[model samples]
Target: MKVLVVGSGGREHALLWKAAQSPLVTALYAAPGNPGMEALAERVPWDGDLEALAEFAEREGIDLTLVGPEAPLVEGIADRFLERGLLVFGPTQRAAMIEGSKAFAKTLMERYGIPTARYRTFRDPILALEYLEEVGAPVVVKDSGLAAGKGVTVAFDLHQAKQAVANILNRAEGGEVVIEEYLEGVEATVLALTDGKSILPLIPSQDHKRLLDGDQGPMTGGMGAVAPFPMDEATQKQVEEGILKPLIQGLRAEGVLYRGVVYAGLMLTREGPKVLEFNARFGDPEAQAVLPLLESDLVELALRVAEGRLEGARPVWKPMAAAAIVLASPGYPEAPRKGIPLRIPEPPEGVLVFHAGTRLGPQGLETSGGRVLNVVGLGKDLEEALGRAYAFIPQIGFPGAIYRKDIGKKALRR
Candidate 1:
């Protein structure tokens, strides 16, 4: 079967890598894929035009189309392909509102008794500031619309919280903001495959969102990630029963035919695991870290899910830990310096480099976006995985390259 994976980032690169390993895949292509994926799959130019993408898929006899990024999913890429009777993995536009609109997700959680943070939505900045004073500090301020994972700010003080509100509301087109009570605990990600009925949970992973080491600085798409998060069995069970199960039922009741990965960003608080957010697709660095552990043929699994036949898919995963450390361009999550030449020495035996934002330059590969590459490492355990990843950091050289020294420090201490 021929397949086309959408998007251009490290996540797409990982998906491309996984799909290439499937013997069932006869031909593979990535729409607007990065330089790293070019080695494995044929790259097709996609200008975010859904109609054109569908046309290309039809013309190329692509058996299945997998979406990698949230933008197109939120815009109804899956719905468009399904309308054409084409097999596509990812949620429809209405189903994607769980990630596209924080307010919508919060309302759904509230209506369905899903575990989540207490939150209120606001369209007016003044009303939002008023609530800020009422709620006090240490609250999370989030843009109701997508902001590339930087939309939410965990403000420690009233001033910072208010500033976040103003920043999100002051956008040219204007947008609503959601302010939720701060839940104290370690954060982890739970990704699951669902066919609008049966839900299959994947290994839990933790993502370090801060740009600097020691969890200091602003939030980025993700600085790095580690799979098989150190979560007690009790906490895992609570998430499965109270979050993932309820979420699937809720979407079904809402008349949404969701068929794809449902990512629940959870804060494992003392009260239990509370969802922080929901993503319509796989997490970025999380995908880089987790896909390597998947022992099943991804093409077959994706096809089954897309066709709403995941009941007996029986997906399998390796019993090993994986870590992905992101290497970013200078000034990432703010003003990034681009076009700098990047020097990545040949990866050590167990390391795989997935490009996030890069391009072939006159000198060599150069940084094209904030986050440039994801260096993934696999080992018998988390520590070994991290050690394998960290050893290659020094070998990679690029002007103004920035990366966190401690990628999986949270799990390491555990």
Candidate 2:
């Protein structure tokens, strides 16, 4: 079957790479794909809109369309593709609003009795400030709409909380602000395949958002990640029953036949596992780390979900672990210096490089976005996986490249 993957990032590259391994996939294509994906997929030009993509899929006879980013799904890309009679794997606009709007997600959780932090929505900055004062320090402020993962502020004090609310409400988009009680604990990401009624959980992964080590520095889209986050079966079951099940039930209660990936950003607190956020599509660096361990054919699995046959779809996974380290350009998470030349060498066994922000330049592969590449390593154990990924980082010679040294240390400490 011919497949068209949407997006141009490390997550998309990883999806393309995994899709390339499926025997059911006859051909692979990517729209506005990065240079690294060119080896496996035929690069196609996109007009940078959902309508154009739907038309292209129809003209190209794309058997399946897999969305990688949240924006496209939130903007109703799947609805457009489905209206044109093209098979696409992504949630519709109504379903994706769980990620598109923080207020919507919080409301869903509150309505369905799903475990999550207590939150309040604010459209006026003055009201937000007053609420912050009432909630006091150690709170979280977030933009109700998407901000590419930079809208969140886990403020340690009242001053920082007010500043975050002011900054978010002051954006050009000018949207509402969501302030919530900060849940204390370690974080993990769990992505699942669903057809609205049925849910299939994938291996859990952990992502680091900070720019530097020791959890210091400003947040980024993602810096590094590790798969198989060492979550016990009991805790995983709690998260599935207490959160994911109710979430799907609520979406159905609202008349949405969702068909796509469901991403849960979890905070495993001393009380129990609670949701921090929900993403309609795949998690970027988490996908980079987790997809490598998937032994099932992605094309077939996604098609089954799109057809609403996910009840019996049993996707397989390897018993191995994976770690991914993202290399970013200079001044990333704020200002990234692009167009710098890159020197990447062929990796050894158990290591794979997925390009996130590079293009074919006059000299060679040059950095084009904030995150340049994702170096992933697979092994029998988490320690070996982390070691292999770090060992191969020095071969890449893109000067001013930034990366987190400790990708899987949190899980290792456990």
Candidate 3:
């Protein structure tokens, strides 16, 4: 099967790399892919036009089009491809609103009796500010529209909450602001494959969203991740019953046929597992950490899901632990310092480097985005995997490069 994967992030790199391992994959292409994917796929330039992408897929006889980013999926890329009679792996526009709009997702969850944070949506900034004042401190302020994982703010005080609302309204693409009660708990991520009817969850992973260690500092896309998250069987069963199961039923109830990854950001509180948010695609560092443990052919699994036969196929995974630590440019999640030449050393066994925001410059490979690269490691246990992950950090060099020293520390301590 000829495959075309969309996006240029570390998640896309992992997907392309894993898909390349399948014997069924005859050819693989990445649209506007990063330099890290050069060895695994043929990179083609994209103009952010869905029609052009569909045409390219048709001309190249792409058997399956795997979308990696949420923006295109939210903008109806799957709809465009399906309209052209093309096989694509993603949800339609209306269904994708689960990630495209926070308010929509919250409302749908409420309608379906899905567990989530208590929230209110406001269109006017003034009303949002007033609501924040009423709600008081320690509430979460979120932009209803996508902001690349930076839109949500856990405000500790009323002033910060108002400022977050103001900031959302200040953006050109800003629309509504959702203020929700902050739930206290450890967060975990579940990336599930579904054919709009049944769902198959991958190994649970946890992402460290805060840029600094100890869960302090502002949030970027992700700082690091660990797969096969340390959750007991009871919690896992609770998540399946309280979250994943109801999610698929909710989508089916809405007459939505979702045929791709359903990334559920879950917060395990005393009450039970509550969804923090939903992403239509795989999480970045999470994908880097989790895909290495997949025992089945990624291409075959995706094709089966695209063909709506996921119920007939059984996916497998290796019983191993994996960890990924992200390397960020200076001033990441803000003004990232780009163009700094990168010097990477030879990695030892069990360690893999997945590029995220990097480009080939005239001098050499340079940092091109906030989160530049992911250093992943796999091992028999969480301790060994995390050790292997941290050991590679000293071998790399770049100006003002920042990364958390404690990536899987939470799980390791347990």
Instruction: Give stretches of model 3 more than 4 Å off.
Output: 172-174
lDDT tens digits, residue span 308-367, model 2: 898988878898999999999998989999999998899999999999999888987899
Candidates' C-alpha lDDT:
0.91, 0.92, 0.90
Cα RMSD (angstroms) for every candidate in the order listed: 1.0, 0.9, 1.2
User: What lDDT does candidate 1 reach at residue 101?
Assistant: 95
- Reference-based TM-score of each model: 0.98, 0.99, 0.98
lDDT of 1 by residue, 1-414 (tens): 999999999999999999999999889899999888888889999899998998889888889999999999999898888888889989999999999999999999999999898899999999999999999989999999988999989999999999999998887899999999999989999999888877888889999999998899998999999998888888888888899888889888988878999999999888888999999999998999999999998888888888888887677889889999998988888999889988888898879999989999898789899999999989999999999998988888876678898988889888
Question: Against the hidden true structure, what lDDT does model 1 obtain?
Answer: 0.91
Clashes of 2: 0
Q: List the residue pairs that clash in candidate 2.
A: none
RMSD (Cα, Å) of model 1 = 1.0
Better of 2 and 3 by TM-score: 2
Q: Give the CA lDDT, 0 to 100, for residue 66 in model 2.
A: 94
Segments of candidate 1 deviating more than 4 angstroms: none
